[model samples]
Target: MKVLIADDHGIIRLGVSQIIKEIDPGSTIHEAEDFDETIRLLNAHIIDLLILDINIPGGNNFQMISTVKSKQPDIKVLVFSAFSEELYATRYFKAGADGYLQKDTSPVEVKSAVNTILSGKHYMSQNIREYFLQGMIRKEVNMNNPLAELSDRETEVARMLVMGISQTAIAEKLNLHTSTVGTHKYRIFEKLAVSNIAELIEKYRIYDYS
Candidate 1:
């Protein structure tokens, strides 16, 4: 098996590469520090599985996954993000990622998710699945998801804010301006009835922020 990992964080790349190598000792695992390098590498070689970060430089994880699938539908793509899957998984699946796992996920789960996705099966982590199910259950009974009222882009921005990332980082990750990110955050706060960052995240926590 050939594995390609794309994450700007050097430590993440080294650690995950170690895990992948340990899991499949004979496999060749390559690394790319950004989306551009990732695609550049992929265009030259067919990778069996891609472990991608959501906040890569050239593309947000969602767009990168779509680009990969649209160009090479056979490759398996799994998102490795610090952002919670509940807020992002549906968008990722819609964007054609094969699987989603949180950054804090254990190495065993990472290996299994990659293996399952490569085998042409869905790899929904138990925690992520629970998040999906909770979302479904909320929708089934007409419960209110305050965040649901926001646009997709706004929701993405809001969730990232609650995740405690800096605005500059969010701007960099989303390919938007610092001002634009601020506007989206303002709109998210308006929609969620939050007056400040503390309240915004606190309200998010009240909703069982899994």
Candidate 2:
């Protein structure tokens, strides 16, 4: 297997590389510390799988998945990020990632996720699976869940809000103007029917952003 591990953190790359070796000692592995390097390697190599990080330089959004797939549609992409699975897993999958794995996942789970994706199956955490199952059940009863109504950008902003990030910080992090962040915040409140941050957080906790 030809595998590429793309993460800015060297230790993480080292650790995951070790796990990949344990899974298949003869597997060829490559490391990329940023999006540019990742793309360069992808163009030059016939990678079977890509372990991607969402926050990598020059590729910090859902578009990265499509960009990678556009170059190598056959490459299985496993999104490995520090982002919460509940808020980001579905979005990544929709963006063409073959699997979603949290950065803090145990080595066993990581191995399982890689094996599943390499086998041509999608992978999600148990929590994410439960969330989807519950969403399906809820959809049958009421198709009006606020989280389900959110757009991709809206959901990203909502997750930052729930994480206690100020709108100003979110704007900076997301490369948007402060006013645009405010507009997203207003829309989120309207969609979720919450007037304030406290209500927003409470609702997020209660629903798990399903």
Candidate 3:
């Protein structure tokens, strides 16, 4: 089995790789520190599994998931992150992840989750599964008009932009070269049909508040 691990933290990447290698010595592991590198590896390699971090240099997994599904629909993604389950599990499942797990989970549970996914089943915390059922049954999901057809990278910039985040701050936050941020900003403005940040903020206030 071949696995690709993508995370910004070298230590986490190393640890995850070690664990996987221990579980399946035949596994060949690859590392990716950012979104672009991850995409490049997936394109160039026939990976059997992907262990992904929620946040990375190019964009968050919300954006990455879509790209992955479009380009390699059969590739399985096991999202491992530090985020609370409530904040992300529902969204990750809706975005097509095969498994959702927190970084703080025990090594045994991590192994179990991976094994569960590899067996062609979904895995999430019990609490997260209950939450999803409750929310779906009660129709608690936000029904806001979906954002326009913004590219994945552009969508990441949009989310940060609407949160009143500064362009320079966002650039640094995502580890992008400053000029690249500006390019994404311009494209976001065009996609959202908004003139500037103020209009964009106003439009996204509902999502932000929710």
Candidate 4:
């Protein structure tokens, strides 16, 4: 089987590659540090599975999933990100990702996710499954956590805000205009009923939305 691991962190790629090798010793694996490299590798190889990171340079949105699929219609994509499952898993699933796994996930769960996707099935954590089921039953996202109400972009901005990243820095990192990042920050504060960064941080801590 052929697999590609796309992540900016070399350690993460190495660890994931090691796990894949342990699972299937003969599997052919490739690594890419960013989205462009990932696409180049995809075009050059017959990759069966793509383990992608959402925050990769040149691709940081839902569109990345489709972009990769457009290149290889039969390739399976597993979104590997630091964003919480509650915040981004469903969005990615709806965007054509075959699976979602957080950066902090255990090696065992990573192996399980890879195996599940390789077997031609979708993979989601039990927590995300319950959230999805509840959303289906209610016909809306679970708003018990106010953070869930933020749009994907807003959520990204909020994370950066809480991490002490400046609006200018966030704009640059996300490839958005400074004014756009400011708008997202305003919406995030309004939605979460916070007035400032401190309040936002406190609210995030209370919700444990990590």
Best by TM-score: 4
- Between prediction 1 and prediction 3, which has the larger TM-score? 1
Provide the lowest-lDDT 10-residue window in model 1: 136-145
Q: Candidate 1 vs candidate 2: which has greater lDDT?
A: 2
Residue 197 CA error for candidate 4 (Å)? Answer: 2.7
The residue-by-residue lDDT of candidate 3 on 107-144, one tens digit each, is 88888888888888999977677867777412443333
On residues 20-133, what C-alpha lDDT tens digit does candidate 4 reach at each position?
Answer: 999999999999998889999999999999999888876776778888999999999999988777767887888899999998999999999999998999999877788667
Q: How many clashing pairs does model 1 include?
A: 0
lDDT of 1: 0.80
Each model's lDDT: 0.80, 0.87, 0.78, 0.86
Tell me how far the alpha carbon of residue 137 in candidate 3 is from the true structure, in angstroms, after superposition: 8.4
TM-score of 3: 0.68
Candidate 1 segments exceeding 4 Å error: 131-145, 159-187, 195-210
* Model 2 lDDT per residue over 1-210, tens place: 999999999999999999999999999999999999999999999999999998787677777888898899899999999866765787788899999998989999999999999998999989878767777524632354457677888877887898788989888777899999999999999999999999999988776633
TM-score of each model, paired residue for residue: 0.75, 0.74, 0.68, 0.82
Compare candidates 2 and 3 on lDDT and give the better one.
2
Query: Candidate 3: worst 10 consecutive residues by lDDT?
Result: 137-146
